[model samples]
Target: MKLEDIPRLSLGFLPTPIEKLERLSTDLGISLSVKRDDFTGFGGGGNKVRKLEYLMADAVAQGVKVLITTGGHQSNHARMTAAAARKFGMKPILVLRGNRPDMYQGNLLLDHLFGAEIDFLDPDAYFTEINPRMAHHAAEAEARGEKAYIIPLGGASALGAMGYVNAVKELAEQYAAAGTATPDYIVAPVGSGGTLAGLHVGCAMFMPKTEVIGIAVTGSAVPFSERIAVMANAAAELLDYDRRWTADEIRIENDYIGPGYSIPSEAGNAAIKLAGNKEGVLLDPVYTGKAFAGIMGCVKAGSIAKGSSVLFIHCGGSPALYPFAGLLTSDLKEDQAG
Candidate 1:
């Protein structure tokens, strides 16, 4: 199927600017730029907005009345899915994996403001019973004669991956308009791996010469490259795209996930401060901060060659900084000094 034939909704600001991080570029002795998906301009703005454009469009086509999805307490995907549901005149139901916090803040707070019906599950139950739980909700909604569209965790389905595939096409146009070829590297954080999968397929289709480097920000039971390959290959099959991605083909920098998902790491926090100070870019602890840290590490270790152009795909989770304020304020090196 042609990419244009795929159903998609206009849910985000298109073709986000690619700007050079002048200060950081000079400091690292490389051409460092950022693809600002952060400015997507929807539901607090993030790359998830791109995925939802396809997922929500599918929901509307199927006459879905309730949008259901699962994620961690601070899930940006859940928050944006809820916003998309409301915008499309459908109900939003979030089956979140974690205890309900005393104070709803960050994406959770916005989930409330979007009027999503939130159901919390303990970590153990979340891993083992999430499908059954979501099924139960779907059954209940069906009983009431309403159809529910259950988006996977992080909306990491093939259809959702199409969002980034299209994004890369847009990116190629931007690069062409600027009178240059694709950058040497395209970097982003890998959590549930939707964005990574999308980048794989998108680069294969549009930016064939470009390399995608995904920094793992969360430890998962399955190897991230394997998971990304599954999503990327599925997305490619949808378009009948000749290139098929394998686990070996999916490039993931696995050293940066930290202790686990959502826990702020030392390098990640430092990168957060550096981005803010150097380029006025606000990155969240969970994703982009860790990604930036990987870039810093690569530069320091001479893995990313000097003078090469690198583009950081800023996925944007700044709202998370509020909840991790204490850590964000503390100097990681100073805590060690004390």
Candidate 2:
């Protein structure tokens, strides 16, 4: 499918700034920069807007009256999809996996504000398990005479994966315009793997010289790499591009996913503080923070050598910080005194 054929809502602030993190670069002894997709124009901004452009297109094509998707309690994808569904005059239903907390915050709050109907499922409900459940819900909607669209978690479908592939093309142009050497490495957090997969194929087909790295925020490298390979191959097949890349072609670094997914790590927190202090950038705890730590570790370990440029894709989730504000504060008393 040609990218131009996809239906995309005007969601993100396009051509997000690509800035050189000179302070961080100097501190880490490597040339580090950022592709600020965080500024993607909308509610708190996130990478989901990119994927939704295509997914929503399909939804509209199918005459969908409602869009259904699944995610964790504080899923940026669910929040953004809710907002997109509203913008497109469709209702959005979110199936939230994980333990249901008493308090609502972060992306969950945004989901509420957007008026998205949410079903908090059992903690043991995995993504695969939630798939049929979502289908059932969509089917129910259809039975009631409503057309519904079921978007997979992270919008990992071939159409949704095209977003990152298109983003690669955009990044390539950005690199050319910046007049810097092409990125030696491109880094992103691997959750559902769609973003990583898109970047893998996009970089391979467009920016052949660049190496794509996936930092697993959840799961192991073996499965994440395999998922990315599968999605990239599927995406390529959809585009009718007869090209293939091995697991070696796409690198996965697992040093920073400390503890588990959505759980904070010392290195991740330090990396978050460093980016904010040095570059005035905000990275969420779950995705970008861990991915940034991986990039930092790779530089420190000589995996990314000195003088080589590395581009960290800031898949935005700044909203996730609000719910975890308690984690960010050193002292509540200090706040009151101030």
Candidate 3:
């Protein structure tokens, strides 16, 4: 089936703005632009909304009443999934990875505000225990006479990746309308690998000349290139496209992850401040900040030549910034004092 035939809900604002980061471009000595997925304008807005549009549409078609998903405590995906479920009059249940914190902040606060039913698991148990049991939880819901649909962490399934496929198409149109050349590189954060996978497939089919780069937010527990290739091929299969991707096609830089997932790093914190000060754009420490730091690192390493055209996909987690206010403020003050 063609991608056009796939089920999708029109939940997010279409064709999110792609703007030039003029000041950042000058500072980096590259032609830099950002695709503002943050402005998707639903449930705090993020790249996940694009994926949820397709995922939730399937839920609606399957006559699901309860939607279940998993993520980290500060998961932007979980919060967005909750909002989309509520928008469609479905109950949302989130199986989160970390234990409940003493205070609700960032996406956790929004998850509660959305009235989602939340359960927590120890970080270690999240992978070995909670993930394996989600299907059982869905079956239990079915036994209760409620239909349940389970979305994997980050909505990383083949169907969800279609959102990014569609995003690349929208971006191509925007670039043409604005009379700009296609970027040489497209950069984004990689967690569950769905967004990057979609971009890989979409770029192969739509913008074959461009290269896609995924900056790892999670540590190297899994080989992201292999995972991304599998997702991309799966998405291509869903669209009835004949193309296949190899793991080598995916280029990932792991240096910026710093400590581990969700833990803020010095380079990421600095990138957050730089984006805010240079272009008046906000980036969350967990994802975009780290990914942007990778972009800067590439520039500094001379891998991305000066004046090379580059596009950064801002996947959006600004709401999560509130939880780290003390860390950010104190660090900035320290930098100034130093």
By lDDT, the better pick of 2 and 3 is: 3
- Estimate, for each residue in 1-338, the C-alpha lDDT of model 1 and write its tens digit: 98999989899988899988999999999999999999998999999999999998889999999889998888888989999999999999999988889999899999999999999999877788999999999999999999988999888989998888988999999999999879999998888888888888898888988899989988778998899999898898999887787799888887787877888888898899998998889999888899999998888888889999999999888888899987776666687889
Full-model lDDT for every candidate: 0.90, 0.84, 0.92
Model 2 worst lDDT run, 10 consecutive residues: 1-10
Off by over 4 Å in 3: 332-338
Q: Pairing residues by index, what is the TM-score of model 2?
A: 0.94
Runs of candidate 1 with Cα error greater than 4 angstroms are 331-338
Model 3 poorest 10 in a row by lDDT: 129-138
Candidate 2 residues lying further than 4 Å off, grouped into runs, are: 220-222, 331-338
Name the 10 consecutive residues with the lowest summed lDDT in model 1.
326-335
lDDT of 3 by residue, 220-240 (tens): 456999988999999999988
lDDT of 3 at 108: 95
- C-alpha-based local distance difference test score of model 3: 0.92
Indicate the residue-level lDDT of 13 in model 1: 88
Ranked candidates, highest TM-score first:
3, 1, 2
Count clashing residue pairs per candidate. 0, 2, 0
Scored by TM-score, the top model is 3
TM of each candidate vs. truth: 0.96, 0.94, 0.97
Which candidate, 1 or 2, would have the higher TM-score against the true structure?
Answer: 1
Write the residue-wise lDDT of candidate 2 on 278-313 in tens digits.
889999888888899998888879888888888989
